[model samples]
Target: MRNVKLIIEYDGTKYNGWQRLGNTDNTIQAKLEGVLSKMTGENIEIIGSGRTDAGVHAYHQIANFKTHSMMSVYEMRDYCNQYLPQDIVVKEAVEVEERFHARYNATSKKYLYRIWTGRIPTVFHRKYTYYIPQRLNVEAMRKAASYLIGEHDFQAFSSVKSKKKSTVRKIYAIDIHKEDSELNILFHGNGFLHNMVRIIAGTLIEVGLGKMKAEEIPEILEGKIRAQAGITAPAQGLFLYEVHYGE
Candidate 1:
């Protein structure tokens, strides 16, 4: 068997999420698997680096699959893209070692959250950003974000319904950047729990709007209670920027 690795990018607006559902084919994973399965004339199970939530986008998601087909790497990539939906694309595909597991071998992941703080409506890319008409203090948001760096038990930052075995994840850095009316928040971490980034974005928004003080972020982290954090930001605003492997 040959281990085939693929770099995928998708707009998750019309899909249920990245994972294949029990009774639904409306997922990025399922779509890719179905096409590959048909093309190779064998069952293909692709393992993704992470499961992106419903309506979230991805720029460079990684996945791997084992197959017996003799198709070349470039052929596989082009064939898959020819059949996959326009919103989803296979940017690269290559043969890899059999031991390379996409999820387990991942070293770090980066996520980006886009916020539109303009008073006027965003006409072109409204679906790609969170719209907030009011002014936000970027400095306050930056101060609140500093508390999120380093390793910590992020129970308060995750959803109560998340089924993770542990919530202790290391956040390497959290950065907030503003360009005109658009604000971008970047998070680099070892891993992220369900809804963790969204919750952090919500908490920072509160600080930016003066609803909460920047110094209160540590208290929220220490509380370790989901209710102590702010609301979960909308899924559309979040994007899986990249996943890193090895050193």
Candidate 2:
């Protein structure tokens, strides 16, 4: 048996999420497994690096599965692409060690949240970016984001329904970049709880809008209450940029 690592990109508009639910009719994992089973004539289980919430897209999400097939990596990619939907694409595939598990072996993950601060909604970018009509003070947002960089108990930023026991996570970086009306926030972290990044983005936007002070971030973090944070931004504006694994 050989383990095959796949680099996948999906629009994530129609599917429920990355993971397969017994009752859910559609999912990214189920689709991939269906095509793989058809091609290999064997039932295959594909494990993803992480689960992206419904409507959250991915640029380079990784997954790995074990298979015993005579097909080459190049041929497997072609075969999978032919069977996969247009919104989902298998960008690349390669054989890896048998013990390599996508989720367990992942070192870090990078996510990007796009925001459009303009008077009118952008027709072309409406699907990918969150449109906020108010003029955001980017400098204030930057100052607020600084407090989030480093290891901290992020209970205030996580969703109330998160099942994770410990909310402490290390944020390696929090970067805010702007180009005209478009604003992008990139977050690099060891891991994130449910809706953590979205809540952080929403809280930062509040600071940018002058609703919250930059100095208030530390207080919120210390509060450890989910209600202390801002709204959870829509998942449509977020993307799983990439997952890292140490070689």
Candidate 3:
């Protein structure tokens, strides 16, 4: 068997999410597996680097699968792009070592959230960016994000319910950039809990809007109370920008 690594890009507007659900076939993993299984004449299941919530897009989602087919990686890429939905594309494919596992081998991930601060939202980017009418205090948001840029117990900032799984995650950096009416927040981290980045984004947004003070971040982190955090930002604004394998 040959281990094949794939770089995938998708618009998550219509899909349920990245993971395959037993009850539904409207998921990114299900779609890819169906195509690959058909292509390879084998029961092909892919391992994604991580899951993206519904309506959360991905620019460079990484995945890998084991196959017995003799097809070249280029051929596999073209074939997948041909059969996959227009919104989902396999940008690249390459053969890798048999031991390579997409999720386990991933070292870090980068996620980007886009906020539109203009009163009138752009027609093209309406589906991609979160629209906020009022101006945001970018400096305040940055100051608030500073508190999040280190190892911490992020139990308050996630929607994860499993008691056994650890909620501690290290955020390498939280970068906020403003260009005209668009504000981009990029998060680099070792890993994230369910809805962690979105919740963090929402809290920072509250700080930007003056609803929450920048000084309150430490308190929220210490409280470890989910209710103390801000709303979970909408999924459309979140994007799985990149996955790093340390190669």
Candidate 4:
């Protein structure tokens, strides 16, 4: 058997997230598996790098599955795209070593959150960004972001419903950039808890809105209390930007 790694991109608006659910009629994984079974004549299981929440988009999500087919990478890509739905596309496909497990071998993940800080929302961007009419203090937000740049117990920033035993994760970088009326926050981390990025975005937004002091970020981190942080931002504004692995 040969392992095939796939680079996938999806809109994620209508599906029930990446994992295949028992009763769910729509899912990215299920769709991919369906197409793969049709193309390769085998019941294949596609393992994703990570799960993106419902309504969260992905630019370069990665997955790998074992198959015995002799199809070329280009042919597999084209065949999968033909059978897959319009919103989901296989960007690339390549054979990899049998030891390459998509989830366990992921070295880093990059996420992007988009914010629209204009008075009138742009029709074209309404689906991808969170529109906030109130003015934001960008400098304050930057200061708050600095406190979350290292390894720490991120219980305050994570969803209480997360089942993970450990909340300790290393954040490699957190960057806030602005262009025109759009504000983008990029997060590069070793791993993340459920809704961690969205909550961090919400807390930063509170700081930017002058509702919270930037200096309070450390206290919030130390507190490890979810209520001490700001609200969780909508998942629609977040994207699984990329996944990285060392050669």
The parts of candidate 2 lying over 4 Å away from their true place are 160-164
TM-score of 2: 0.97
Local distance difference test, each candidate: 0.94, 0.93, 0.96, 0.93
**Reference-based TM-score of each model:** 0.97, 0.97, 0.99, 0.97
Clashing pairs in 2: none
Each model's Cα RMSD = 1.1, 1.3, 0.8, 1.2
lDDT of 1 by residue, 123-193 (tens): 87687899999999999999989998999989999985756588899999998899998999999999999
After TM-score superposition, what is the CA distance of residue 159 in candidate 1 from its true location, in Å?
A: 1.0
Instruction: Give the winner by lDDT.
Output: 3
Model 3 lDDT tens row, 130-239: 99999899999999999999999999999989989999999999999999889999999999999999999999999999999999999999999999999899999999
**Model 3, residue pairs in steric clash:** none
Writing each residue's lDDT as its tens digit, candidate 4 over 117-168 gives 9888999988799999898999899999999998999999998565558899
- What TM-score number comes out for model 3? 0.99
State residue 66's C-alpha deviation in candidate 4, in Å: 0.6
Model 3 stretches astray by more than 4 angstroms? none
Total clashing pairs in model 1: 0
Worst 10-residue lDDT window for candidate 2 reads 158-167
Per-residue lDDT over 3-104 for candidate 2, one digit per residue giving the tens place of the 0 to 100 score: 999999999878898989899748999999999989998999999999998889999999999998889999999999998999999999999999999999
